[model samples]
Target: MLLIEKPTRPLKLFSLSSNKEIAEKIAQAAGLPLGKVSSRQFSDGEIMINIEESVRGADIFIIQSTNFPVNDHLWELLIMVDACKRASAHTVNVVIPYFGYARQDRIAASREPITAKLVANMLVKAGVDRVVTLDLHTVQVQGFFDIPVDNLFTIPLFAKRYVEAGLVGSDVVVVSPKNSGIKRARSLAEYLDAPIAIIDYSQDDAQREEGYIIGDVAGKKAILIDDILNTGKTFAEAAKIVEREGATEIYAVASHGHLTKGTAEILNAAPIKEIIVTDSVKTDQALPEKLKYISASDLIGEAIVRIHNREALSPLFSYQPDENKDDA
Candidate 1:
């Protein structure tokens, strides 16, 4: 009998147009170079992606965040994945740092489609074997895809950041911008050994209640936490509410900073001293001085390496209030 040992598949990392800066950082952190690929848009607004190198039998990882100009970026990723599939790649894994259309997870009004599910279906149909995303707007969105979906958290990253800054004490308070964000706030609060507060201006189907801050923030330093910072209205309003409640200082923290039109003006004009966000969504727009970005490359890079090695990813998901927090 003849024995032929098949060589192990090679890992190939690629980056699309969106968030390539962080992709480079991820590649550097992973000790891998990004594979060559080119993208262009036709005069008619059609997108074309050309994989410069062969991907035959190679495990491919593509990093893309569908952020501003959402449709264009989404189309680019879908096209790239399809091209990889056609090129006989061994496997195609997608890392979407900022999942677009995730906020449309459900129908709030009549005749509205669940666009988040629709996006999931589209990606799965585009031949993705697995998906890695950061801090999904709704965890339930994972169920929308049949393929394995890993939703990584930014709380641990934020926890480490604040802890190192010596902001982990009783005088610190985690304030949720909305009622729905209380859980996110509470988690960070627990990590920091701080109390949690909620600024709720929820308008029920019947009545509209004015915004109020729950829990004590008087003379406390506030960290307003939210998943995404878009339009900046939520954070701006929440900061004002917290300020009115006698919070001495306010800092805004978010997983992804979309920072759409007028967001800088809004956030800068707010009473916030600074804003901390991850490099999940790369933006070229001139950022404000208050905006400080902590890199997520290390975390996502470690994740990619572990997944490539078929190692368990739970360690990356778990965090505690220990003095030494593990850096991903």
Candidate 2:
């Protein structure tokens, strides 16, 4: 006999202080209104979150990027999740555009904490049913969490942008500043139909100053790719390397642009021509003219819709957003 199932819970979207701009865009794309949420800080640097509307028996998705001030934003997300659980929300889905502490995924030294796994444990303990985030620093971080994780890619977004800008073909070469990032660079290289190259480091300091290109970058438009653009040091160093190797033009692309202390000025003075990043994190600091931000709201918004409907999210792995829809 066919059994009847309970009706699907009402869907709700909420944004935290980290990235309200992208949250609004996601809400717009999902055809949903931003749910009421009030978050404030106390004198002693404590965080408090309140859900203004009833969320009982509803499916809730919270948008928060744990970028700078990582602790505070992370706490806010935990509190929000707890609140949802307490309010009887059917399921709590978290959308983290930037997963902080991701680089600390491995124990490089003695007594070092695998902070990425620790953070995953915290979120799981705090009750995040499923996690949806953009490119993680390391894909293996997914294994750290027992909960389901949908790690989206920004390759298609970056590819679409450059393809339209006419930055494709043989002249274009995707370069990974370090060896570990070859997979990311290869994805873009395949998308742009360009060659792939890597900048390998050497034990000898003099060797570093000499030829570092693993593949030919001479007279090519070098596109440097990475997961995070933190200090701009790596990109700047790689830019100089490519420039010295006879690369006529340079470009940098990453999923999250933290633009930490002195990063903007550093990239501005570097040999790079232009830098492109997604609106995964919000920043008020003055950015260089060479830096541009595109929105991942459509990509994220579509993922949220599909997740809520219990649909597959594999297509978003290489999802390309339209110029009109994905540009910030």
| Residue pairs with backbone atoms closer than 3 Å in model 1 (clashes) | none
Kindly give the number of clashing pairs for every candidate: 0, 0
- Local lDDT at 64 for model 1: 97
Tens-digit per-residue lDDT, 17-66, candidate 2:
99899999989888789999999999998888889999999889999999
RMSD of each: 4.8, 3.7
Tens-digit per-residue lDDT, 203-269, candidate 1: 7777965689879999999999999988889988889889999999999999999887788888889
lDDT of 2: 0.90
Candidate 1 regions exceeding 4 Å error are 1-7, 202-209, 319-328
Residue-level lDDT for 114 in candidate 1? 99
Q: Which 10-residue span in candidate 1 carries the lowest summed lDDT?
A: 319-328
Clashing residue pairs in candidate 2 are none
